[model samples]
Target: MNQNVATSAPFLVFTDLDGSLMEHDSYSMEAAKPALAELARRGVTPIFASSKTAVEIIAVQRASAITAPFICENGAAVYDSSGKILTAFGLPRASWLDAVHQLRERLSLRFTGFSDWPAERIAELTGLSEGDAGRARSREFTEPMIWQDTQANFQLFQSEIQKLSLTTLEGGRFISIQSQFDKGYAMKWWQARHNQPRPFLVALGDGPNDVSLLAAADAAVVIKSGKSDQLDPQGPATVIRTSIPGPAGWNDGIRQILNLLDSQQLLIY
Candidate 1:
């Protein structure tokens, strides 16, 4: 909670948005902006790794004033500081479509493809709320399709590679499949390329989509409120499991990590 310690710790902070940074339904990042910006001013780079599309992530980045590389669509792609595509991991488009079609044919569920369709068409077919659909279209970059509830919707979306996909059902909140992309793979890719002397990698997330990145990090913080724990079988790192929830919990979690770094003399706060 003390602002002094945060500015002294130099570390690569990768965070997930939906439940980690923003509230689940309200989607507010206002509370943490100052701390995040202060961290950046002090030589810490806050990298955003999330299931959101590149466009959506970029908007969040701009809002947060973060110019760091971003992992989008669950690590399907890692965009560099220049915003150029550095590395992309996913199946080919044709193969991805084939898999979707085949899965759609075999199962009993609704289907939608991220194909280059007009936003109107996407909304008509996938039945995404007009507001959410509009946001997807307004973005310069975004995941292609929006599918509804059902195993068919889940499988059809996950059957492909290359681009990341998000599946939202009627009674359920959205769930992002690792498939050909995600946070874990993105963070690992970044670590390999930069090869910086990492003080101690830490990842904080709130959902199954964050599991991969959490597993990859030296330390992980899982926000407990939603179904994230049920979605994650492995759970968070044993080192610091603060009982605080939401943004308060996240801030506390980071403080805990900084405490460890300070004790080790790796940081000064």
Candidate 2:
């Protein structure tokens, strides 16, 4: 956590990375600078909750010149501003990979995950540079894959993995298999650690994987991503749907929330 921001700050923001804060195809966050700067100015902490790896999140933090805690691997782990693992909700990556291997052999599943491809291949698939792809491949908790099998086979695969105490998250671009946990679980853990009087929780995301996080927040921002499976959080949070997509939507959503908070005089500063 950044020491400049008080632990009892009035607001805490949780945001997903790809397709929410970053562009869906280009992975750029240029349009969100205004909102990000406003949060910084207001001493509000933004916690990144995403399916990205710790190193990938760290790289984003460094580039953005912000230091805050992050939830990675679809809520498998939480890391501090210094990229230190504060807590983990899942088992080791090797264990999940081994289970996947066994399931594939037994069920003849068809999928190519990060472990099955070289950094170059991953770069080709995700449009990431080779260096970024390598960072992404350094997984500690989950296996993100491109599911190439039939729908029936995929259903069977999910059933088989569930038997092993693992589950899948359908991210914007891949299906991630990991230990049974969601972003909401990790967010609650982070909040418990930081609570003084309990900050106003805000969350933003654009995929099914983000549903849990959105539901857990006091305010939910659903960014438009052109996907048919639009997220509809079933929680009691005040929901804000963005008309635009990506960081532009993210920017609008955050500003709108801040405006609401200001009007209510809920903001401390």
Candidate 3:
């Protein structure tokens, strides 16, 4: 792959991390190196939009050699390439926890979330190294929780959370408690913030939490996930799925999307 393949216009990529670019268990993005290299060469901006914390996203950014902006904590915050936060959507973690405390006592919604777990516990649960788990534990605007109640109770909890104006998302693993904005809102806000004309948006994700993002893109690719079953994004946006899993699937999806974009003269390399 040429490192000098420059694109005529910016190709905006808003991607998920865990099961899309990074391997589920190994947590490595080695297989996506080809596509990463190509995107870097073409100067196509790849921005991570995940449920990961800033430090976790930083680690991935370092490994992937990406210097563009990133959306963190399930779109609760957006940060620029220079590591500066561009925008924030929700209240701080402490405030949310305060609300959770109230809800827990009042409604008896049984749950265990990232905020309730220490770094060591989180490490054991997610198979991340201690340091990475520590970073993951350092959430800002959201809490990813596991419901420990019956179906009726869970539905009740979801309804009450909604009434509080908070959003509950069912991801591949945890049930995420987030701000009103999802990844799709973050993607759109990032695009709108760009001074350049609207770029062709391409998003790739593999989990159920990624549905909104896939739905928002001009071209969305759903990678095969090892941690979860395939998702059906019920949206009008052009969509595709890779047969392979993990970063191999990611590589295929990005390359294929680039070719399709090139054909439409929407991209150059």
Candidate 4:
């Protein structure tokens, strides 16, 4: 939280990280620095909502010099700026991990999850540094995994997991196993805390997992991605798509939306 940023502003930007605010491969936010600076200048709080774990999200916030709170593990939990759990939507990671392990053994599933891999292997798979990979593995809830089985087997796995009261979400690079809650549930929970002047929520994301997040927002920005299954969030009254991909697209989308809101006098600061 930059001291210059005004938390009193009636606006909030909830953004995804991996392929939305950061680049897909390089994992850099260099291109979005200008937009971030503008956000700070405008006194708007940017809350991160991602599949990353608490430690990983905290590390990203530290790197970016941001102290705002975050929603982690694909809406499994919300943590304050200091990494304290504000609210949790899903069961503990161990519960989900145990169920996944049991299903894998019973169904002979062929997926490699974070709990089954070493930090080095996770680093190799995700292009993250070994240190960051370790942070990613420090999950309090949910398990992100790469599916390595046939489509039919994957469907069987999903069916079995659903029977056990678990759900799966396909992210930018991995499919995560967790409880039924999605990003929208977490966002609304966070929003409910503000009663004086409820914030105007804006969400930006670029994956199937982000669909709930986008739909939860009063405004949504769908950042372009190189992947064929580009997201089309349907609920928001204002949905803007960027032409470019990665952080550049993130930057453009933010600027465009802010300008649009300002022109329409929708921002109440």
Candidate 5:
């Protein structure tokens, strides 16, 4: 968290899951709860923007006791506070499997397509380790696509999917294949549809997957992880870097934002 940010009611806070909010191993939220509640008390809302499925995002929202807006599937769907389906925008409905089948036939490449499949089925397709496959399938928190040797396949998939008017986002493990999607598009849609206040917006994320929404915010914070380099390669003013890692980084980071609020006499208790 950076001390230079502004904090005011009606502020919008967007955060990424996994490495940004929860520890890689423990998935803890002990420190985050109070900060969230405080934001709610101050009329600030927390929006979850992550490369997770709708089902996974719903469960996390419930677990965190947050009812704010959520961006799922790396900004494919946005859910409002009441849990109503605010909007769905992303990849065209053409069959991805059919596209892959066609591309592989024409370009001579290997590829696979997955929907909301069971853990075992996903593991079988991607040949992921048992533990990794189990986590992906369990859906206790996140639902991510599994890709088998993604790099080579993704390039081909991108060109092919584009033919069908769709795009793919690179998940750390699995590649999220969908119609052209970007977190910024989803965020802008939310802002436009809701006509929400233009309060100081803050976003925090880790991973190359989060680059777009990180750039969309009034102020952005990057968790000191491998993906930090992906943000503002050319440099940006509103971007801030965190020193801590994972959930600890979130705690320290948000605290820094809140402290800035305190300094400005904006936050109460």
Candidate 6:
């Protein structure tokens, strides 16, 4: 480990949690242990880019011993490794919810957002334990809602959000409404702070919410989902989908990407 020795180009790996790195239903990353170990061995950086709130992602970070900065709450914010807040770009939760409340009454939209649900109900809906649900409910920026309405009305609701200069995005379980912030925005901000030469970004996700994050990456891994929709992002990088699902797919995908890089000497110093 000589200080004068050179390394390959900096590579950052950003990933979604629930359905990409962790089991979709079981919420486990135990299957991807080998890939994680290999990436760490090669000095690769993996950051969790997720729709989960800061509190929720922090819990996962602590449990998994991942110290890299993370993108959270549908890219509402990014936090550094030490838990210092890097940015707060999303709309205020209270103000956003207040508007949604008025919109619900005015449009008669049958929407039940996280703000309306108790932690127990949230836990039941998500199959998360009660304690985990509490962390999930501590939303700081985005308001994810379950819209119980027709597709036509849902389209109309999104139109209304656009008119208000707000936004809506679909996730694994809910649709998020908030400011113009997104996963791409968060990634760009975090990348700016790195002083290294332009790094190769490797992002992975399995849901619609991760489209932007995937699109922003130099190489993207779209994990397969049987119960959810596929992610298709418009980008110039190499894109691949795992035939298998969850962390198993995650492991296969990362290893393949590394092999590709090494064969091409793509990131060699």
Residue 207 local lDDT, model 6: 90
Error of model 6, residue 32, in angstroms: 0.8
Model 5 agreement with the true structure over 39-73: per-residue lDDT tens digits: 66666666788776666666766766666678887
- Estimate, for each residue in 50-70, the C-alpha lDDT of model 3 and write its tens digit: 999887897877766676688
lDDT digits (tens) for residues 88-151 of candidate 1: 7754344345554555567644645445466676456435445545555542222344455576
* Each model's lDDT: 0.59, 0.86, 0.80, 0.86, 0.64, 0.82
Say which prediction, candidate 1 or candidate 4, comes out ahead on TM-score.
4
Summing lDDT over every window of 10 consecutive residues in candidate 6, give the lowest-scoring window.
1-10
Off by over 4 Å in 4: 4-7, 265-269
Error of 6 at 113 (Å): 1.2
> Candidate 3 or 6, higher TM-score?
6
> Cα RMSDs of all predictions?
6.1, 2.1, 3.0, 1.8, 5.9, 3.3
- Candidate 2: tens digits of C-alpha lDDT, residues 1-269: 24343576787889999999999878898999898888888887688999999999999888777788899999999988778899999988887688689779888878889999999999998999999999999998899999988999988988888888888888888989888888988998888876467767889999989999999987889998866147888873488999999999999999999898879834433
Tens-place lDDT digits, model 4, residues 121-202: 9999889999999999898778888898999998898888888788889998899988789898899898888876778889
* Candidate 3 Cα lDDT to native: 0.80
Evaluate model 6: give its lDDT. Answer: 0.82
Better of 4 and 6 by TM-score: 4
- lDDT score for residue 57 of model 2: 93
Q: Indicate whether candidate 5 or candidate 6 has the larger lDDT.
A: 6
Q: For each candidate, give its TM-score against the true structure.
A: 0.71, 0.94, 0.90, 0.94, 0.77, 0.92
Quote the positional error of residue 144 for candidate 6 in Å.
1.4
Q: In candidate 2, how many Å is residue 164 off? A: 1.0
